[model samples]
Target chain A: MTARPVLSAPPAIERHTISILVDNEPGVLARVIGLFSGRGYNIESLTVAEVDRDATLSRITIVTTGTPMIIEQIKAQLGRLVPVHRVHDLTMEGPFVERETALVKVAGTGEKRVEALRLADVFKARVVDATITSFVFEITGQGEELDRFIGLMAELGLVGVSRTGVVAMSRGPGGI
Target chain B: MSAATSETSLTGADIVLKALRDQGVEVIFGYPGGAVLPIYDALFQQNDIRHILVRHEQAALHAAEGYARSTGKVGVVLVTSGPGATNAVTGLADALMDSIPIVCLSGQVATHLIGNDAFQECDTTGITRPCTKHNYLVKDVNNLARTLHEAFYVAKNGRPGPVVIDIPKDVQFAEGTYRSPADSMPKSYRPQVKPDLNRVEEAIDLLAKAKRPIFYVGGGVINAGPVASQLLTQFVRMTGYPCTTTLMGLGAFPASDRQWLGMLGMHGTYEANLAMHGCDVMVCIGARFDDRVTGKVSEFSPNSVKIHVDIDPSSINKNVRVDVPIVGDAAHVLEDMIRIWKARGKQPDKAALAQWWEQIEFWRARDCLRYEKTSKVIKPQFALERLRAAISGRDDVFITTEVGQHQMWAAQFLPFDRPNHWMTSGGLGTMGYGLPAAIGAQVAHPDALCIDVAGEASILMNIQEMATALQYRLPVKVFILNNQYMGMVRQWQELLHGGRYSESYSEALPDFVKLADAFGGVGLRATEVGQVDDVINEMISIRRPVIVDMCVDPKENCFPMIPGGRAHNEMLLGPDEKVENATPEDGMVLV
Candidate 1:
């Protein structure tokens, strides 16, 4: 049997970092997540915390990747969520800043231990905890920078890693 | 009515009842259970809001939707916790998709026992959040009345949709202040209703210069109330342009009007779809460009300068980009359009539109709805036509339908002369929507003839609602076109799935005559075409709940179908019909 011809779709996947302002109420976060999951939209990373305690508002930072059309649909669908007050695509709206924190644990000795310590210092990672066999370093930076640090630590006996997903804000005076 | 005194005096249940009364809620569709006993007790004490106890929670919600759609008001529903709330999910999603405003009051397990897996306890607010416009859980007694009022406000205003208020059992018994609508206005939520005049002017400019134009309307006009429908009619009449309505927009403009092209998209008329494809200028009012309507968006109305008038900002440019986007209520924006057009002293190009009408007439002459009549079996289209002919001259008739081939047949054959006369599950295409909706309409308009044009498969979805009609003594006539299959699915299977029937057949269907009798209602059946008219007449003459099962030709399929994923111009005509204007096929492009 001959193979059927495959219709290739455009392989241009772009990552979008979006910030949403919403009511800090029970199930509000679930609702936002449900909108993505129900429609089968992919969310790469998501972080939410209460922002204005007095005003009862929360800010959710979501990193997702899709085609241009899918991204537009995601934003439109998110805006239709009742608790969501504002949705900003930081990636589309000019220059923006994003950062993530990771805790890296390295188990090593001798030259590997010395090299790990030297690399941590170079990456501005603080030693939060230490044991005889392992040291846990707290690193905070952009996703790619943290990825680089983790990559180096992997060769020097990386044991475990934990990360807080990307949090983003538009690079301007105005807030979403 | 003093705030201080009432704040210290009223229990939560009493507060809810009083607030509902103040909001002028005349009826509520509900099912009582363990968690909602306290609210039921409050309901027992009051006679202002009549409660119709539905057999199932889903039917309660569907009935409320029917009530809302037929009357153009916020429908109210009340149900107990857990399964009761879970059962209402389908109806809630249906109402949300159709932009029907319904306020569902659901009982919950007491506050302290909420996440402890208490009996009849479920995460109602969590479950319904994605389905509702807004939802609230009243944790404290003090917030109950305000939250309830706010739910109503959020539900009925701006792109109307269902809202849920999950009231914990303890909160229902605890004392709280009774708040009125005038007292508790939502601080954070106020929808912008008026359109910017600049956008209105832009739309008018586009409309005036058009050589070929078609007005497309949807259910949003019906939700905007009678004034909007009146304005839509006025504007369409003034322009003298051809108009086509989505299934939801059926009655917004009188179907009898000469300018009317029948419901467009999917199973829409050949003329309507052709007009949509060929128009140079398309004015879309109160209608979202749903996938069913637009077909393949890239090829939808390819040469048109589109103007979309909608109440929801999110709806505009969501599916298709438009030249002019006016975000406002249908009535308000139409008023502005009329005003701007008059100010410019511009008339539609009559000579140019005459040529467009000539093209539309050629498509119309094809009679896409036509089918060969037979003496042996009742065709679904002929049944609806006979039903329509029997109900002719009756202006107070309301039509509701379960989804599928029968629904499309009803849209094609029936003539709705006024707004709010047609109610069906348009967006969600919920199957068992018709029976309960008809009961709801009958409850609203007791003297009006309310009919549920249902299919055998779809009617069985919410068949238990027949009990609600009997209990309420509602004069609802159920006209079931018994084709013995999920006809639409069967049609797709025949055309697209190599004739694999799958599980689309309605096996062991109930005998409607016996079933109606068992439910304490009248039942009629007609197997032959000769018996169709007499049975419909008998069904109409009944002053009580009636079911008329008209057995239709099982092999017949809904035609003039824009087979899913195909463009509007590429329609599949019925059997024995010649294809008109066949485009050159790429062979690789298969829909």
Candidate 2:
């Protein structure tokens, strides 16, 4: 039997952090999320918060991965939503800031516990809660940093983990 | 905004009527129920907006679509909660697909009983979120008028589409200050209606240098109103370029014009499809590259430097990538294109263009639409030809169709010379869209002859709309090409499923003549080829609603069919001699 030769390799998949400014009214979030799910666009991480009090506007940060064409479609589709005022692709629009927070709970003692604390210190993770057999660490940083800290904590008896999905902003003085 | 006196405050139901009146909505196609009793009561007190009560909620929405498409006005629909709302979903999706501007007001349960699983209650907004262009759940009475106005604004704006407002029953009963459309402008929604000058210039540059250029038009031209169609005709005339319309775009250009190449797509004419495939420059105005239009997307207009003009920015590059993408209303873009073309004073390569036209003429000589005519039985194409002969050259004649082989035949045989004269469920392919749609058109233009070119099986899907036509006194004609089976499905089965047939046959069919008479309308039947033209004339002459059942060859299949997943060049022009005798396996590859 011969292996079938690959007809074509797929296009490179790139992650895009898109920020959408929308009315903070009822079902606005659902509308944005529905656009993603309905169109079969991939959403990796999502965070939303009310950004303007007087304007009643909410900012939604989404981490999505797709080919360049699909990413363009995502932004265009998001911009087409009725309540949406603006959509910015942070990944493509020059330099930007992205942050994620994670809580790590490690249940261990002795050398293992000491090692976990030392690693937390190096990662600049604060020990939010400490028990005789466990330590709860509060960490806020880029997604990769949290991922590394969580991965290291796994060796030190990582019991539980909670994370707030990544939130993004453009580095320059620009508004989305 | 505070609590006011009764003189200033009006109930939400009254506000709904007042807001519709304010919006200059002439008519509303609706069906009332338990949740909408308050609105119905308010409707009883009103006289401005004429309400046409359709038998099914689905028919109401489709009827509204017909009204919208024919009149270039935002079609209004009203239906009660749950079943009523669910039924309208198909029509909503249809309007969304076709970009028909329709505002649908669906009644919901009492505000407090919303999530309690109360009677006749569904998550109307949630269910309709994906289908509608935009939707709202009006919870408060004060917001009712604004939402209604905003709904109209959203529906009729750039890339017009269906919008839904799910209003709770209590909100209808509650009193709130009524506000006009100007007071409650849309807070955040604004669509780009003007094309980028640079992009327009780029498109003009492409058109100017083109050797084999073709204008591929779609329904957006019609949705942009009559001026877009006029601009398209003018632009095409100015360039003297070959023009072809998609199924939805049929009447945007004069079908009788010398430069016209029938409708282009799977079942489109040979010359049109070939021209599309062979073109060096393709100027696509207000038409998305739909799958039906672009058979085997990878190979669609491969060599053409394509320019796409659409009001919706997202529609551009959604399916087929274009070299120049202009985001604007069809009218505005065409106007700018004309201005720029005139200012630049650049002409197409005449020598190359002459060769292109010669090639197009050579392809046209094949006459792919010519089918075998038999004296013994009426072919669907022959029937449509006779019907077309009766209605042709009349500006007031409008045609709607159910989705099937008959619809394609109507597109092939009937030449539309004006925009909005042709209305069919192009995007959603919703069956039974014809009958109610015809009624809606008749309601819009009472004196104009509106006809639904229907198939036997597809017409039965919403056959109840015949009653709606009679009740409204709308003299719409239903000319059914009565083939015994679901002809399209049967044809596909023959090609793809080894002629299994399955359940495509329609058994226990009703006596359409008796059914029509029972509803107090005229029904004419013609089984013989000789009687086709007579019945069509008689059906047209009648002032009341009529159904002409033209029995056609049951085994006949629609031709010029680029089978699914096939390239445009691989279309099967049906057998020239005898269509009924030719099986799918005869001289054809499966794929």
Candidate 3:
């Protein structure tokens, strides 16, 4: 029997990060996520905050994998929530900057320690904390940039890692 | 900012009333209490805004949900604070999950006493934050116009949902002004409906290339109406796509279409599902990938690449990973798809798709969604069949339902030949939904038949609606499948819940015949199978609010069920599966 193509499209696909402005209410996010989760859409990274101080509005930044066609659709639906005032596809709008903050800790006294600092310095990652046997590095950038930095750290005595999920915004004057 | 409008004096209650009146709100369901006495008193002055008083706060909210779901208008509800505000939670939660539009205004304790837990004080906005689509806490009377304006806008626009506003009792007594309607509501508040032409073009391009294409229309299409219907058929003809709907999406297309897959999911047709599973492309419209439709997520439609069209942006990649996400109202986006397809001068190979249509027909011929076996007592299908015969092809007729074995049976068997004739609480899965919804639908279209197909236990949740129906003199037909048990739950309990029935069976029931008779309407409680046709004929002859307590097979459980916590396609059907004939001869066995 011929196998149906699973993971058929790509060997390595570029992942894009997106953030949406939604109403800060109970079912708003669920309705948004339900739109995804109900349909089997996976959000690689999701973070929501009631950015409008009055708590009347929320911004949900979601990082997902797809072609540009899929990204446009996500923007359109996010604009449809009653509470949703606007939607911004940070990836599509040109020249937008992206960042993800990660707290990394590695414990070692041998050459692994020297290697960790060497890699951290090269990545421009900072040591927020250091002890007799361990060091904690603080790194912030696009998820991929952070991932690459963590990958090199992982082999060199990676111990624990804490990440604040994705938060996104548009590049220019108009805000969603 | 203008003195001409700003200086005008209007109490908070006056502002609330004016805002609602501006929205053309003709009816509101509510209850009175200490915190909201001023608003209710002001309501007495607004002759145009009619109020319906319900026995319970929950009833008011459900009625509002029903109104919103039926009329496609913002459902407005009012209740006092504390217990009153808390009571509306169920209805809010129900609307929230289902994406129905409802604006609930709750009275709060005086603002100064808010945190003290003073009498009738409640943080309605906070308590409802998780359940409502959006909620507001109005601290000043001056903000009343904008708050109510935003509440209505938020509730009715984009992924329609419930919105709540907490009004302090003192605010209602304070003075405010709402002279300009535009001032009350911001211009930026409208939901963007322009379809993504690029995504639409891409979808059409994919459709043109697809050899086996299927379009799954959902309730969102029905909600989008006239425009949605106009665009859907246009797309199907151009794309040579066979379109089907879920229970919620009934009227999105003509059931008579050879392209129609009559509802798809748990109780959905075998061939329709197989066709979806085997399709080269699936265009999912306004429908979330509900578990009932996609049985096992991993096993769902392996061969098909999905294209989800929904107005909510987050839904695009939420559930099933979509190849193409088209965000806009189902109707609006469909319009763009049709336009793009026509502009491209593309023609689908209809003949090439004939084989797939034949496959759907093959399934239709083998096992159409039917349960027809003429017998002794009234068969539920006969009741339905008779209802079908009685329909005069009126485009306005609506059939809403409560969730249960009977509900599945209705969705499976009902012949909704026209659009807008089928309605139900799909996403919320709220039972006891039929009676009030039927009444609400009847209220929306007084000249049309607004009928409800309900189960015995489910109807009891809002049986008082019979009074509402009779009060309105609505000719809404109520079909109560009185098997004296929670049939759907029991079927699962016996089949999967270890056969140790726990509260799944109900033996005590008030005589529904007398109940309807006392309510000043018709009630036909038939037991013998032969009575099915006769009682249905009699009930139709009256054409009024009536209840037909037909004795369905007590053991006549709905089949092709996907046990709870399982995927949609994984049904509990086997060759050994048997339900009682439930005929008088069997006396309806408990097992």
The top-ranked prediction according to DockQ is: 2
Question: Fnat of the models, one by one?
Answer: 0.34, 0.72, 0.21
- Measured over the true interface residues after superposition, the C-alpha RMSD of each candidate is 2.3, 0.7, 5.7
lDDT of 2 by residue, A1-176 (tens): 44644567888999999999999999998998888889999989999999899999999999999988899899889988899988999999999999999999999889999999999999999999998999999999999999999999999999999999999999978767
Q: How well does candidate 3 score on lDDT at residue A66?
A: 61
Kindly list the per-residue Cα lDDT of model 3 for residues B428-527, writing each as its tens digit. Answer: 7778777777776677677776778888898888888787777768777788877778987887566644567788788788888888899998888778
**Worst 10-residue lDDT window, candidate 2 chain B:** B578-587
Candidate 1 off by > 4 Å: A1-12, B577-591
- The Cα local distance difference test for each model comes to 0.89, 0.91, 0.76
| Superior by DockQ: candidate 1 or candidate 3 | 1
Predicted candidate 3: interface RMSD?
5.7
Evaluate model 3 with DockQ and give the value: 0.16
User: What's the TM for model 3?
Assistant: 0.79
Task: Give interface RMSD (Å), model 2.
Answer: 0.7
RMSD of each: 2.9, 3.0, 7.3
lDDT of 1 by residue, B384-458 (tens): 898889988899999999999999999989998788889999989999999999999999999999999999999
Q: Which 10-residue span in candidate 3 chain B carries the lowest summed lDDT?
A: B582-591
